[model samples]
Target: MLKIYKTKLDEEKKLLEDELGTLGQVDKKGDWEATPDDKMVTQEVQDEGDMADRSEDYEERSIKLNFLELRLADINRALEKMNGGNYGICEVCKKKIEMDRLEVNPAARTCKEHMDKVV
Candidate 1:
């Protein structure tokens, strides 16, 4: 039953890691730090418009990195639960999570009833 979920989780983890690698660098603590997409910000003589574009690109990359990191965390947690024999169990209600919800998100930590209430 968990084989499919495990496979999906592994695939997603790889893809997210790859995407995150392009957008940022992983710190020594294993946390991803967002970096500017435009590597041409080296010289100190940048114009206002150029600086603005670089700043905007960095903000975009930061936002994307954050989202991807969150998803990766969820996938890791789900995989851990699977290893612990607790996968598909809602963290909130402790009920069996719906298959439909699992289908939609293999990393889901809650059932459809408590999806929005999850922290």
Candidate 2:
């Protein structure tokens, strides 16, 4: 069961990274930043306006990238816990997390009872 969850989490992480890379680039500190490609630039005033429009698009992408990055971090943390023999244990209650809950979100840090306390 843990192996299945890990596999799914790993797949999701890769997809998120791929999606993020398409709309942005990873910075030196491992943060994703949305940026327009050079091809968006052209030799015309209207092209300059297009650049501005692209900037707005990049901003939206940045917001989405940030969300996905946070999820990826959570997934990675769960994977790390599995390696340390702590998989499926709720952080708040230290109880075995429900399999159903784990199925829904393998990265969850708390059981259903402490769901509100999850960081």
Candidate 3:
């Protein structure tokens, strides 16, 4: 069962990395930053509308990247727990997480009882 969850988590990590790569690049500190679309425009005359569009696009990418980064962090933490032989245990209550909850989100850090803890 743990092997299955690990596989799923690995696949999810790969997908998140791919999606993040499309919108941004990892920095020296290993944090992902959304690439500005304006950087792609070289010597291209841009009107105010064009500049606004570029800004909007960059903002959208930043939002998306942030979400993906959070999910990736969860997945990474789950993987670390697996490596430490502590997978499927709630971080707050130190109890075995419900199997159904694990099935729904293998990256869960807390049981249903402490679901509001927000890791």
Candidate 4:
């Protein structure tokens, strides 16, 4: 069961990293930020209207990159726990997390009883 969960989470982490890499590169702190792909566009757009459009596109990419980064963090955390022998333990209650819940979300940090709790 743990092997299966780890495989799935590892696959997901790789996929998320690949998706995030398309939008941005990793910083020194390991955080991903959207890299503006429009250096030429910035140079060409002298008008305020064109500048605004470029900014909007950059903002959308930034948001998507941030979301992917968060997911990657969760997946990495789960992997770390797996290595530390605490993979299936709930963060809030410190109990063994339900296998069914782990099956659905291997990155879960809380048990089913504390599902409403936020970290």
lDDT of 2 at 22: 86
Best prediction by lDDT: 3
Per-residue lDDT of 35 in model 2: 74
Candidate 1, 1-119: lDDT as tens digits: 78999999999999999999999999999999897654555774267787777788889999999999999999999999999999999999999999988988999999999999986
Candidate 1 lDDT score relative to the true structure: 0.90
lDDT of 3 by residue, 1-119 (tens): 79999999999999999999999999999999999774547654347777777888889999999999999999999999999999999989999999999999999999999999974
Q: Model 1 off-target regions past 4 Å?
A: 38-40
Which digits, one per residue and each the tens of the lDDT, describe model 4 over residues 1-119? 78999999999998998898889898899778898755636556767777777788889999999888887888889999999998988888899999899899989888999988955
**Clash totals for all candidate models:** 0, 0, 0, 0
Which TM-score value belongs to model 3? Answer: 0.94
Q: Which ten residues in a row have the lowest lDDT in candidate 4?
A: 37-46
Compared with the true structure, model 2 gives a TM-score of 0.86
Superposed model 4: Cα runs more than 4 Å off: 40-42
lDDT tens readout by residue for model 2, 1-119: 67899999899889988998887888899888887655566553366777777777777888888898889889999989989999889998899889899999989888999999976
Q: How close is candidate 1 to the true structure, as a TM-score?
A: 0.93
Give the top-scoring candidate (TM-score): 3
- Measured by C-alpha RMSD in angstroms, how accurate is candidate 4? 1.5
TM-score against truth, every candidate: 0.93, 0.86, 0.94, 0.90
How much is 50 displaced in model 1, in angstroms? 0.2
